[model samples]
Target: MTPPLLTLEGVELGVGGRRFCENLHWSVSPGECWGVLGPNGAGKSTLLHALAGLRPVEAGTIRLQGTPIETLSRRAVARSVGILFQDQEYPFPATVLETVRAGRYPHRPFWSGESAEDQRLALTALWETGLEGFDARRVESLSGGERRRMEAATLLVQSPRVWLLDEPTNHLDLGHQIALLELLLRKSRGQQGAMILVVHDINLAARFCDRFLFLFGSGESCQGTGEEMLQEALLTRLFRHPMRAAHFGEARCWMPL
Candidate 1:
């Protein structure tokens, strides 16, 4: 069997002399979409950061496509991976087009202007993200959903092989939430690349991801197919709720626990 595109082996992440989670082993294969489910303060964000090579690993190793993560330069890593956090702050004043254009930075030489190809890719990304109509709008004036899409557009322009997203549906309405989830599923499962998302909605994860990683507070993790793992009893235990799963046309929907 072919090995996974990304792997975390006995990983340990710490901050300010304290460890949040330790000894994590996870892998992501091509054409796979993995959803990370955990309660608040469960170090979900920390885990994402560690996987993206943004945080210092106290022990163990991270490899991207069999290459040690540390061996890649920051720019090279950025070119290969795109990450969207739950809360991203933009202090600079720039048009939405300009902001998305920033995504092309990793692909261009420093101090160089965007080429014709970069411009074409940027515009295509905007169209893919549903921001074509608002390309020239100020970033500070976009609605919550629009801003989220704008950030997604930026990442799309990166042409990354690996995607990391945190709480991607938080600001989206029901319709857009479904749309985004569908897009993610299509891309990850078809031809784009591997994707790992930190999602709090169990139902959404069940419907979209090929695999699920349940992160527990006890420093252990469980991963398997949605069908094999998203049982009512297991979910009840995982979330400390009376939740139940409902089957809906090749997907499992969540109801109150």
Candidate 2:
């Protein structure tokens, strides 16, 4: 069996001193896309933050590629894991190139600018995300979907072994959503890396993810292949809705409640 690329044991997090989740344990293997499902306030985003080392772990261990996340330096972590948060706030007026260039900060110093190799990487990422021609465009002027793709491109430039995406489908149109998910799957599969996405859309999650994790009050109750785990009873209980599932071609899609 392949060792897990990332593992969380007894992990816990909180906000305003309130525990979000406790005693959480999960493992993700290379080339697997794991969708995290939970109701509002279930700490899905918090879990991603913990994996990315953006927030300190209060209780347990997060090991990335066999090393304890806590022991890794911030720069080392940045180099090993790339995160696309739900909220990507860019306060400065930066062009698309500039914004994506920031992804290289871990490798480049603040005083110096990007080198030729860095520009090549940034452009390669932008090209992959379909923003190749918009290098000079201001990030603020792009549509929500475009911005999301750009953010994805930025993370790609980091070339991490594990990609942490928080609600990546948010605000995207149907076409863009499908396109982005497909692109991510293709890229991660090629790299033999892992992608852990925090998603609320059950149908989308079912369609894209190879495996799924369902979170309840405090921690995940189940995780397995989508076909094995996305049962009607589980969906209804997880979302508190009378939901159903149907086979569409080779995939399972969640029916409207």
Candidate 3:
């Protein structure tokens, strides 16, 4: 079996006096895409933050490539793990290309400006995200969906081995949503790549993710393949509602009753 790229052992966290996750043991391996599923305030985003080392866990260890994440320098972590935040904000005025180019910060020295290779990578990422002609567009002038796609482009330029994405599809239309997820799925399956995304779309997760992790927001959680976690009873209990299952050919779907 292939080794894991990232591992979480005995991880626990809580927010606003509510305990959400406890004793979380999970691992992400190369070429694997894992879906983080939960209701609101279930610590899905919180867990991703912990994995990225941006937020501290209440307890437990997070390892990247078998090394304790805490021991790695911020630059080291940034070089290996790239996070796509749910909310995208551009505090300073810049063009779309300039913004995407910033994602290469970890690869170059602090005094170094954008390199030619970096520019090429940024352009390639923009084209892949369907933002080919957006190079000169002002960041603030773009719509929310366009900005989200731009963020995806930035992550591509970052070129990290592991991706931690929070609501990667927010503000996207149906076609754009599918396109972005397909792109992300491709990235996660690329060379030595892994991904874990916090998403509210159950069908999208089921379609794209081979592995599933469910957080109950009561310090209880579960993880497994889709076949083990996609049952009506599990999802019904998970969402605190009655869920009816359907099949579109061999694809399983769920609807709240």
Candidate 4:
């Protein structure tokens, strides 16, 4: 069998003195899309950071392609794994195209510059993310939604085997949200890559994700398909609110009751 794209074995994560989840074992394989769902302060972002090697794991191991992630160099990790945080900023003045082109750095030599193909790919990524004519726009001047899409475009340009995204739907309008998720789904299917995203919208998670990791914010967690895990009682307990599961055609949705 092919090794998983990413794996966590006996992992523990926390902040201050509070434990988020302990003894966590999970793996993401190619062609899979996993959603991380929980209430605020549930350590969803922290978990994504830990997987991306931005934060240290309290205990246990994280492996990429069957090798310990810590053993890999930063560039190697970047080439294999990509992350999109909830908040992104461009302090320096740069065009959207320039920002997206930066993703190609991992594939180029230290002394080399962006190639024509890289530029082409960057343009394609921008177009796919609904920013076709925004290539020349200043990154700092773009609106929040535009900037979010620009970040998504940059990640598309990177094209790593594993994608770790924190609230990818942030700042997106409903139409853009659907478009972006559809684009990501298409990318995962086409490239046979894996995606793990932190999402607060249970409905959206149900629509796009095949697997879910639920953090109960009490050092307890669970993982499984939405059909197996979307029980009203479990969700109500997890979020500390009454919830009703509804089905609209073939899509399952959760609404607060």
Give the winner by lDDT.
3
C-alpha-based local distance difference test score of model 2: 0.84
Q: RMSD in angstroms, all models?
A: 1.9, 1.9, 1.1, 1.2
Please count the clashing residue pairs in each candidate, in the order shown: 2, 0, 0, 0
Candidate 2 residues lying further than 4 Å off, grouped into runs, are: 109-112, 249-251
Q: Which ten residues in a row have the lowest lDDT in candidate 3?
A: 183-192
Write the residue-wise lDDT of candidate 3 on 95-212 in tens digits: 9999999899999988988889999999999999999999999999999999999999999999899998899999999999989989977876776799898898899888888899
Question: Which sections of candidate 4 miss by over 4 Å?
Answer: none
Error of 1 at 82 (Å): 0.7
Q: TM-scores of all models?
A: 0.92, 0.92, 0.97, 0.97
- Writing each residue's lDDT as its tens digit, candidate 1 over 87-137 gives 987798889888888899999998899998888888987888788878789
Candidates 2 and 3, the one with greater TM-score: 3
lDDT of 2 by residue, 91-132 (tens): 768899988878888887658878988899999999988898
Q: Order the candidate numbers by lDDT, best to worst.
A: 3, 4, 2, 1
Superior by TM-score: candidate 1 or candidate 4: 4
| lDDT tens per residue, model 4, 130-149 | 89999999998999999999
